[model samples]
Target chain A: MKPSQRLLVLLFSGTAALRGGGFFDTLDDKTRFDSDALGLHADLSFMTDATLYVPELPAQGLLTSDDHVFFVPRLMTFFDAQMGDRLTLHTQMRADRGFDPGAVPDGDVRLDEYYLQGRILRDDDLNVRVGKFGTAFGSWAKRSLSWNNPFVTAPMAYEDVLTVSDRKLAPSGVKFAQRRDLPDNKTNWLPILWGPAYTTGLSVSDRIDWVEYAFEVKNASISSSPEVWDAAQVGFPTNPTFTGRVGLRPAPEWSLGTSVSHGTYLQDSTASLLPVGSSVNDFTQTTWGIDAGYEHGRWQIWSELIGTRFEVPWVGALEAVSGFVEAKYKITADLWTAFRWNQAAFGDVPGLDISWDRNGWRSDIAFGWRVSENIQTKLQYSLGDKSGREPEGNHLGALQLIMKF
Target chain B: MKPLPTLLLVFAGVHALIADGTIEGKLSVESMKPSPSRPGYLPSPTKQPVLKPESAPAIVYLERDDGVYPRTKTNETVRIRQSGYQFRPSMVAIQTGTKVDFPNLDEEFHNVFSCSKAKHFDLGRFRKEEASPEVLFNKPGVVKIYCEIHQHMRCFVVVLDTPWFVKTDAEGKFSLNNIPPGDYSLKIFQPSERLIQQRVTVTDGQTNTVNLTR
Candidate 1:
C-alpha cells in the first residue's frame, strides 16, 4: 500500500473505541496517526444559516434575500500535514466564494489560507511560516472561526463599511460624507480593518515566561481584498505591510494584549487620481489596538479597542475609533449564551468640519446548544442603526446549524 | 477428625462465600462504522474522504433502584495527567465525592477546563511542576474535560454514585465483586454518554456471567 493509505489505515485502527462526549459532549474526533514520523489530519465544519431582516442589513451585498428571509449555506475545511516534529503544512478552503471581500476570483471554492511552517526551537514554539496566513494584528483573528466565535457576524470594526474607498479616491469630503446616505453602495466603501487579513506573509512568534510576541510582514494592507493577497496579483504593491502583537498572561485567568499594523490602503486604480506631487504609495493606513480577556469558571469575557487613521488622497488623516466587548456564559454543559456590543465613530475631516463617515453601534445576543459532540446550533438577534438613521436595516434574527467532521 | 474450632471456621467461611456475589463480563465496541447522523452526501467540491468512528472505552456499573448506592467516603484520589497534549487514561469512572488530580506533566502549559453539568471548572494554565491541581466530584454525572489551549486534548470523568463500577481493560474484560445478592439495573455508559441498561439478579454464593453484546 501507498504511504497515504498506510497513514489512513493507521489512523482508523483506533476508531473502534467507544465514543465519548467533549466538554459539551459529542465533540468531533481529532483523528491521530500513531506514526510519529509523518501524519495528515483534517477537520471540516458546515454551517447553514437562515436570517430574517426587518428593514435592512449593512454590507447589503453580503447575503441575498428574495422576500424578507434569506438562507445561505457554507462549508469550511482545513487540512494539516505534519512532515515531522519540526515541519508542517496547513491549508484552509471554503465554499463561499464572495464571503471575503476582494476575492477577485469568481467561483464556489476559494483558498483562504495555505502556509508552510518550520519550528526553530525543539522545546519552544519559536517558528516561521511562509505563504498566505492570517494577519498577526488583533485578538479577533485567532477566534474568527465559527466554532471559536460567539456570533455569526464579526465585529463592526472588521465587517461594517465606511464611505472611504481604496479603489476610487473621493473628490471632496462633501462627497465622501454624502455617500453615507447610500449605505448600499458598498462597492466603494471599506471597513476600517478587513476581516481576518488573509494576506500572503511571513510570521514568527515565541512565548517566554509571561510574555508572548508575534510579528509579520504581508504583501498587502489589512484592508486589501483577498484577491490581491498574493504578490503576483496585478495591483499588489512592492512595499510590504508590517503587523505585530504583544500579549501578557500574568494570571491564568486574565490576559492582556496590544497590536499595531501599518500598510498602504489604496489600490492601483487610484494611481491616476493622485495629486501632482505624490504617488499611490503616499497613502497609508496606520492602526493600533488593545485587547483584554478574562476566563474563569463558567464565564468568559473579551474586549478590544481599535483606533485607526487613514491618509486619504486629498483629505489627509481621517480618523476612526472602533471596538467591542463580548461575554459568554455557559449555562450548562450543552448550552451557552453570548452577547456583544459594538460601536464605531469617525472623526471630522481636516478643515472640512464634517465627519468622514457615519457613526454606528450594534448589539448582538446569541444562544447556542451543542446537539452532540460534533453538532451545534445557534440563534442570534441583533439591533442597531446608523447616526440619525432609524431602522437602517440593521435589525436581524438568524439561526445557524453547524456540524463538524 | 477436625477440631470443633476448625468446623466452626469452615462453616463461617462457607456462609460468607454464600453471602457475596460477583458479576463478570466482556464489553466492546459495536462497530467502528461512521454514525448515521452525518450528511449523506458531500455538497463540497473536495474529494470524498472515508469517515471514521469517534470512540471511548465502556464503563460498566450497577445501579440500585433506590437511587442510592451505599459507598464509603474514601479519600483515595483518582489521577488524570496532562501530558503530550493529551489527557492520560482519557476515560475513568469514580465514586461520587472522590478527588481527581489534574497534574500537568507536559513541558508546556495546559489549561484544563470542563463545562459538564456534574462539575464546572477552569484550572488556569499551568506548566509541569511538582504540585498538581485537583477537583472533587460531588455530583454524579459525566464530566467532560478539555484543555483550553489544545482543542484536540480531551478526557472524560464518569462520576458515579455507585461504588460497583469498573472500566473495561484493553481486552474488554471486567469483573465486579462483592455485590449484595439482589436485583440491580446493570448499566453501561459509553464515553459519548450513550447508555445501555439491563436487569440482573444475583443469587447467594453465585457468580453471574452477564456478557453484553454490542
Candidate 2:
C-alpha cells in the first residue's frame, strides 16, 4: 500500500480501538446500556492566559501571553465477569495530542496519563482496588477535564507545589478500601478506609485518592532536561516528590477537603556566594490547603482556604495564604452564571513582622450557555489587584463544542 | 299524553336518589426559598387560570350503574401526556391491577423505565402518536417513573389497594361519593412534595375538606 493509504489505515485503526473501549458514550445512560455495557469518555480543552509583570518581578516571566491546548482522549473497559468473584478487572488507556513541556517554543503535544485497575473485593463493607490507577484526591482531581472545571486552569497553589510536568495520568502501585455505615440513621455517619487503590501519582487523581480519609497520596521520582535552558547555569537532578489529600462528605450535597505535600525541586545552583560548595539543596517546597462546598437547588456555593510554605536555599521560609469564594446560579434550564473572588497574602518569613506583604486580589465573572445538549459556550472576564502595582485585568471568552457517540 | 304525568313523576324520584359528591384541592409552595429536596418551586396548582373557581378541579369520573355493592370496575382512559420530554403529572395514584397506559404525546421518542423494587422493567423506545404501552400494576407502593432519553425527566406511579380516591381541584377541594358510609384512609401523592395520609368517616351526603402545603 502507498504511504498515504498506510497512514489512513493506521488512523482509522487507532480511532476504532479507542472507540471500541466504550469511553465516548458515558454521558447518556440509555445509550451506554443499550449499545454496550462498557463505559467510555473523551475530553479536550484549549486555553490562553495573559499575565502582567510588575517592576518588582519584571525579570521573571511575567505579564506574558501564553496559549495552551491539550487533547486527551482516554479509553476504559470493564469485563462483564469479576476476576476473582470478589475482584473485577477494569483498565484504561489514554492518548494525548497536546501535553508538552511548559517552556516549549510553540504548540507541543506529548504522551500523557495511562493505567489499569481491578476491584479486589466488592461487598457491603469492604471494596478494594489493586493495580495502576489514577489519583483520587479531590472532586476536581477526579474530574480534571478543563471542560468540566469552572476555571480554565488549576489553582495556582496546586500548580506551584505539585509536579505537573509529565502527564502522569496514573501513578505507577496497590490500594485497599473499606466503607462501613454507622448505627444511627438520624445522624449521618459513614466511616471509610482507603489507600494506593493500586496506583501512585501517574495521574492527578492518584496523588489524592481517598484511602484513609477521603484522600489519597502520590509519591514518585522524576528527571528531565530541556534544550531551551542553559546547562551550565542550572544542574539537572532527579527529585522525589510526594502529594496527598483528604476529603469529608458529610452530606449528599456538601463536602470538605484538605491536601498537603512536601517535595524537592531541581533548579540552578548558586554556590559561589556560599561558604561551602554545593551547600544549597537545589529547592524544596511544602504546600497545604483546605476547601469546602455546598450545592442545593439551583445554587452552588464553595470556598477554599489554602496556604503554601516554601523554603529555598537562599530564599528562606516563604509563606502564602489564599482564600476564595465562588457562587453559581442557574438562571434558566440550561444557562448559568458564576462569580468568584480570590485574595492571597504572602509573608517573607514564618514569624517576622514585615512592612510590606506581597498580595493579590482577583474577581472573575462567567456566563455559560448550553447551546445544545452536547455543545456549550462560555464568556468570562477577570480583574486582579496586586500590591505595589496598578490593577491589571484580562478578558477571555470561548465557545466550546463537544460531541460523543 | 296520559303517560306524560307518570314519566315526569318517575324522573323526579330518580333524580332525588342520586347524590353528586365533588372533590377539590390546591398544590402550593410553602415558601420561596428552595427546599433542599425540592429546589424548583413549580407554580401552585390553584393559580392555574384554566382551573377557575367554578371549574376549580380536574376530575376523573366513574359511575356505578346499579348504585349498589358487588362493584364491577371499568378501565378509565387516564392519559399521562409526554410533553417537552417530561411527564405532565409528576405524581399519579392508581389502584392495584389498574392498567396504566403511558402515551407519548411529544414529537420526540422516549424510553420509560421503573427501577423501583416493586416493579423493574424498561419500556423500550416509543415514538410520537404511537399507541401507548400499558403495564398492569399489581403491587402497592410508590414506583418511580423516569425517561431514559432525558436525565431530568421524572415522575411517580402511586399504586394503592383501594380504588376509592379523588384528586383535588384548583380550589383545594375533593369529594368521594358512593363510599358506602365506611371508615377508610385517604392517601395523597404529589411530586417533589410530602406524602399525606388521613383517616375519615364517610356518610351518604357528608362532605370533607383538606388543605395541604409543602
Candidate 3:
C-alpha cells in the first residue's frame, strides 16, 4: 500500500478505541504512546443515494446518477514536538479518498487540510499560523468538519451556501484566542457572561485582514478571490468585502448570535469589446443571518434565519430569505429522533428568471441509533415543495453509518 | 460585672450538651486525572455523563447519643416527588431506622421500590393525595429506588449510622454544622465523580475545612 493508504488503515484502527464518553480520560495516568506521539483519526461514511437538485433547470436539475452506495473515507493526522516549555511546532495533514469524480484527480490521496500553528506567546494565549485552518464561523461549522455534527449530512442551507467546495477547507491564516471567567450567573440580568474572553488578528490571502473575538464583535475585510492581488492594471479595482459578527450566551441554556457578510465577486476588469468576454461588471452578494439554540435535558431545539441579496451589476438584484427550526429528542440514551422544517423565498428580479422564485418549503425527519460511542447509524427522509415554479419538489431518503475517532 | 454569675450559669447549661461545637466548611468538588501536564482524550462512553459536571447534591444525617442528636430532630420526613415521570431529587441519604416517605405528587399513580443490597421494599401504586408509603431503613447502605412504570425514574436511598455528615449544595459545597469538637473521620460521596476521605480535628470554637477533587 502507498504511504497514504497505510496511514488511512492506521487511523481507522485507532478510532475504534476512541469511542464512548470522555470520562474514560481518567482511566490511565501515564502516557500510552510516547515514541510516536502519534495522532490518527478516520471517519468511514456511506450514503445510499445522494442527490442535488437545481430549481433553475427545466426538469428540476437532478445530479444523482449512481445508485450504488458511495463511501468517502477521511484520514487526518498531526505531528507535534515541544520546542521547550513555551514553544511548540505542529503540522496537520488530512486526506479524503473515494471513487467520486468530484474528488481529487487520479482517485488518490487528496489534501483536505494542512497547516502549521505555533505558539507566539505561550502564556499570553497568542498563536500564529502560516498554513490553512478551518474557518471559525458558526457553531456547527467549527464543531468539526468531519464528524462533529449530530447528523451524517449537514443542514441543506448550510451545505449549499456556506460550503464553498474548493475553498471551504482552505482556511490559511493566524488567529489568537484566550478564555476568561465572568462574574455573571443565572441570577444576573444576563444569565451568562457577556464579554470577549480572547481575540485573534490575522492576515490571509489577497491581503485580507480578519479579527475574531470570543464574545465581542468581530470584523473582516477581503477581496473576492485570494488568487488575485493587484487590480489596478487588471481593469477592476479589488472589490473589497466586509463582515461583522456578534454572539452571546445570555443564559446557560440559551445562545443567540448574528453575523453579516457583504462582498462582491469582482469581475475580470480587462475585457474585449465583444459582450461575450465581459457581459457583467461585478456580482455583488451580501448575506446576513441570525441563529439561536437551546439545549435542556434530553431535548435540543434550534433555529436560524438567513437572508441573502445578490445584485448583478447590469441585471437587477435577487433576494433570498431562508429559515429553519429543528428539534431533537432522546428516547433512550442511545436512540434519538429529530424533525426539522425549512423554508426559503427568492424575490423576483427583472430579466433573470429562476425556478426557486417566490417561496419554498422542506421538511426532514431522522432517527439515529448509536451502536457505541464512536459509531452511529442514521436514516433520514426529506421532502420539499416549491410554490410558484413546480407544484411538487423532490423527495430523498438516505441511510448512513459513521465511525469516528 | 456583678451579673457575671448569672451569665456563667447559662453558659454552663449550654455546654452541658455533649461536645458543644460547630462545623462550618465548604466542600469543593474538583475533577482530577493522572496528569494535568498532558491533555487526555475523553471518548463517548468515557465522556462526562451530564452536559455539565453537576455533582449530586446530598443531605446526610447521623443519629447518636441515644436520640436524633444532630439536626435538632431524628424523625425525618423524606419526600421523593414524581414530576414529569422523573424523580425530582435523584439521590437521598438518611440515618438508619429513619422512615422514608414517598409521596406521589403527580396526577397519576406511582409504584416505588428498591431491591439493592442496602434496602428493599415495595410500595404499591398510589394516587395523588393518597397516603404515602413508609420504609424504615434498617441497614447502612444504598437503596436503589425506581418506578415500575417509568424506566428512567430513579433515585437512591443511603442510610448511615454516623451522626456527623453534610449535604452538598448546588455549588458542590457542604458543611457539617454543630459537629462535636473532636477528631472525626470524613467521607464524601458524589455519584460517578469520586469518593474522598479525610481526617479532621475540630477545636472548641474553631472549624476545620476539607477540599477534595475527583
- Which candidate has the highest lDDT of all? 1
Candidate 3 has an interface RMSD (Å) of 20.2
Residue A158 alpha-carbon offset, candidate 2, angstroms: 4.5
Tell me the deviation in Å of residue B101 in model 3.
21
lDDT of 3 by residue, B1-214 (tens): 0000000000100111236665544444343221111221111111111121112454433244344334332477677776655565666777676787877666445667554556656565565677886778878876656664443355656677775666666555445656666666556554432345555565665544444333
Off by over 4 Å in 3: A1-65, A76-94, A97-108, A114-131, A144-146, A160-241, A266-281, A351-358, A388-393, B1-214
TM-score (all chains, Cα) for each model: 0.74, 0.44, 0.46
DockQ of each candidate's interface versus the true one?
A: 0.07, 0.02, 0.02
For candidate 3 chain B, which ten residues in a row score worst on lDDT?
B1-10
lDDT of 2 by residue, B1-214 (tens): 0000000000100001114433333433222211111111111100111110011122222223333333233265455666655576655667666777788766445667664545555565566666887887777676766664453456667665555566554433444544544444444553333355444444456555433322
lDDT of each: 0.67, 0.40, 0.44
TM-score of chain A of each: 0.86, 0.57, 0.59
Cα lDDT of model 1 by residue, A1-405, tens digit: 545335434433322232233322222333323232334323343333222222254433233333354444456766665565567777788775356422322437767788988879766667798888888888888888777777777888887767777887777777666666765445566787778878987899877777888899988888775567766455346777899999998866677999999988788778899888888788899999999998765677899999998899877799999999999887765688999999999899877777777788999999987554445667778877778754247677766656555
What is the docking quality class of candidate 3? incorrect
Deviation (Å) of A105 in candidate 3: 9.5
Tens digits of per-residue lDDT for model 3, A339-400: 98877765544443432243557777888765443355667677665553342235655555
TM-score of 1: 0.74
lDDT of 2 by residue, A60-121 (tens): 11112233321222222222222232333333332222221123334443222333333222
lDDT of 3 at A329: 74
Q: What RMSD value applies to candidate 2?
A: 21.1
